[model samples]
Target: MKVLLGISSSIAVFKSIDILRGLLKEGVEVQCVMTKNSAHLISPLTLEIISGKRVIIDLFEKRERSDILHIEITKDADLLLVAPATANIIAKFANGIADDALSTIFLASRSPVLIAPAMHTQMYLHPVTQKNIEKLKSIGVEFIGPYEGELASGERGIGRMAEPEEIVEKAVRMIMKKTLKGKKFLVTAGPTYERIDPVRIITNPSSGKMGYALAEEILRRGGDVILISGPTHLQPPIGADIIMVESTEEMKNEVIKNLEKVDAVIMASAPADFKPKISLSQKAKKESIQYLELERTPDILEEIKERKGKKLVVGFSAETSDVVENAKKKMISKGMDVVVANDVSKKGIGFGSDLNEVIIIDREERILSTGIKRKKEIAKIILDFIEKKLSN
Candidate 1:
């Protein structure tokens, strides 16, 4: 696929090269275009070398071909992506002011346009810029991020350009037809920690990888996703509404609160089945402690059933024994539309691992088992199954 990458004037202009390289590595034909101001920060030669194509920086620069350069590139390109898209450029595009090569191409291009904004926190939050963004969105212009983090201005805020990998993912998603448009999802991930004392807690080994993968797939397919995540070190997927929680009770409350707003719920978190009946505020002395009382924590999947009318509920069962039989039992008991069961005892394919093997079971006794695969691939398989069921 052909992609036109536009770079604007920002300290983040340097990161645009990484974006170009990532696209090229993905076998995408990248054509680099830069605003005049961007050329001062990074030489166009670098981009030209990375993309292996002539860089377009000037509107009037004569080309060897007879066709107008901007029109030629924009007319046939599959996607037009603006990295480090500054507030100035966003305003220009929003207001239809196409004086420069990039803006002119943006106006002339019929292809899907995606802008990754990078600016100061105040500038990004400014009403004018926000309005311009809304205006552009109204016309179907897509955006990736001006992520929250430290900026070149020696301040931390929501103006950092999205990472190149994430930008590439969003670009690829934009070019593909959206299958889950207008759909909403609720996903829970990670291992919930049940506090026993001030310093002691009980938890599992879940890494939240599968849940995060599921959320990313939902976003890529044009769905809105809310991810309730337990304490995990993984970076939250871009475009997800992330709610951080600790104990099972918190996860349960958040899921219950948002369950009705979503079309489906994917329970991927491994909440501790039991918690200490009494949580002590002070740390207990190890030598003085006797057997602790245990009680079942709230069952999030089953509780959500009451509030999940007409909505699909998908549950995950990580069992060391009788994976399918136990999972099917839980699916029926918890009222899950579908259940994904995996054996954590399997080597290299569960718990904290990046790979997984799963058996997907439905209400009608239909079953589909998968070989060991990356969690991202497994996520897609699960979603494919859910999509078919939803359509039916």
Candidate 2:
């Protein structure tokens, strides 16, 4: 396969050489491009020597002998890859701001695009960075990993780009899953809080990992995603449009705002059971330990069902016990076309973990369960179900 690699400014960029080595070993042709900032960390000539292709460092470098312009030439490759994708570079791609050579190649590419994000853990975890990733996923881009490991700053956390071989494996898997190209999805995930005071709130442990994984899986299948998520510590997939919210009410508002023009809505966020009867204007001090009045919050999924009209609605039910039975009931009660049920009581299978085991029940009562697996693998299973149902 003909591959085009885009390197951005990140300390982890030296890893790209290993990726180039791996790709060449597999007999794939490699072309390299580097942003001006990335060149400071890794030499352009080094890339050219390793890949046997002259590196393209500028958008208007005189085009050498190609009749086509730089952008046009870069567009002809099978895939465009960005290793060690910095937050700044991601923001550019997310906002359609092509100020640099690598950004131009990304925007110019017609082929499939893959990104491997790397940065400071705190920066990667910031909401804005997560939103940029979400927006890119919503546009049909793919990503490998910003796995958890020690960063150059001597702090250990997420934001390490996946190992070069693992990146190629993901790319190969992506190339294999061209089944749902150009499809669009509306996905929701995480726990919605209900605030009683500026600082006090009620929420579940729903981590939104499954939902984010599903979004990535959808992108890998060459699909667009609109991911609406509630309060969670997790980052949205690197190429989705993320709508963030704190309370179920806010989540409902955002969902209603974006509900149109979507193929399906996956109601995965576990909205609050009840809200304060009187929400305080300021943070309530618990030093006094006073009794608090409470009122039920609006059922987001049910409201969604009432207003859905025609969009497919899927719900998630995390039960401490009696998973299937409760999920079946929730399917009927929430007016969901499909209900994804998981047993949270099981060790390592729920909330905050990288793996999940789930049973999907449709309105027709067809139950499909997957064994324990990585969140991404489980997402693919869910997408397969979604694709099959959509086709029918």
Candidate 3:
């Protein structure tokens, strides 16, 4: 992978060295480009020595190539990354102000663009800056973070550059081969809530991390995603068509509604198995309700079985015992193409955890066990399996 790293004037320019090193560690060829003002903060010589290529500082710098320098740099780049991007550079890129080498490259680059903004909190929050960021986003430019933390001004607020590791990871995702390109997927996430009253409801402890990770991986692989998510604090992945639902019925309806448009269905949500048979119109007093009647919620998988028409259906089985056995049974009973079974009973994984260990079983009884891996890693494995199956 080749990444064109653009560095603009900012006090956070020092962090760009780490970003360069990280990308190099990933075996990515990085060509460094710096705004004129940034050269004062970090030496071009230092970047040249590390990247083993002369850094481009001047727009008119003489080169051996007959082609335009800025245009040539972007032609073979897989991604254009700006770490510690100053507000000035951002505005320049947003408004077609390309008087400098870095900004000129931004105008000429046709590859995926990833920006990590770093500026004063107040300047970053200004309406003009926000509008510029939105304009870039609307055109599919990705942003990592201007997270809340100690800033260059010594005031705590947003505008801190994301860690170098995070930026490199995002860049890698952007440059990954689009194996899932031109495919549409429906992914269900989180735990559904069954309302008992205006003030109370029944739900599970699922944090939705697994499902959200899956959606992100799918998007990274260039798939169009319809994410039917239950209530969770996690932000929806950029580029996904997000649908929020509270009850099992709502989730089912939305899934079925969009089922025909998707090439696959990844049912990652943990919907409430039962709901109050007769919910009270108002909040019931402690003494007013001695017992609560319950009934089974709608079965989304079963309902879609007849309507799916050969669409790949991937189901999840969160079990306490007989994990693989139960998942195999569910896969067969629901006509699922594959089933991911994980023992929620285990500690440090599953439910609200970021890590998971799953046994993936397919219709052919092929089983693969992923021993204790991050949910993000597991999501990639699942997607890789799905991609291979679809290609077959």
Q: TM-scores, in order shown?
A: 0.77, 0.62, 0.74
Report RMSD for candidate 1. Answer: 4.4
All models: lDDT? 0.91, 0.82, 0.92
After superposition, the stretches of candidate 3 with alpha carbons farther than 4 Å from their true spots are: 11-36, 39-77, 84-173
Best by lDDT: 3
Poorest stretch of ten by lDDT in candidate 3: 59-68
Off by over 4 Å in 1: 21-29, 35-69, 76-78, 86-104, 117-173, 238-241, 305-309
What's the CA error at residue 297 for candidate 3, in Å? 0.5
In model 2, what are the clashing residue pairs, if there are any?
133-238, 134-240, 134-241, 135-240, 136-239, 137-239, 137-240, 138-239, 138-240
Q: Which regions in candidate 2 have their CA more than 4 angstroms from the true location?
A: 1-13, 17-176
Which candidate ranks first by TM-score, i.e. highest?
1
- Candidate 3: pairs in clash: none
Estimate the TM-score for candidate 2.
0.62
TM-score, candidate 1, is: 0.77
Q: Model 2, range 1-392, lDDT digits (tens) per residue?
A: 77888898899999999988877765678888888999999998899999988888887767547664556666558888888799999999998888767887777778888999999999999999999999999988897789899999998999888888778656654554577676777888888878777887788778888888787777777778888888788756766888888887888888888888687888766778888788888876688547878888777787788788867788888888889999999888888888899998899877888888999999887889999988877887887888888778
178-244 in candidate 1: lDDT tens per residue? 8899999999999999998989998989999999999998998888999999999998988899999
- What residue pairs are clashing in model 1? none
* lDDT at 1, model 2: 72
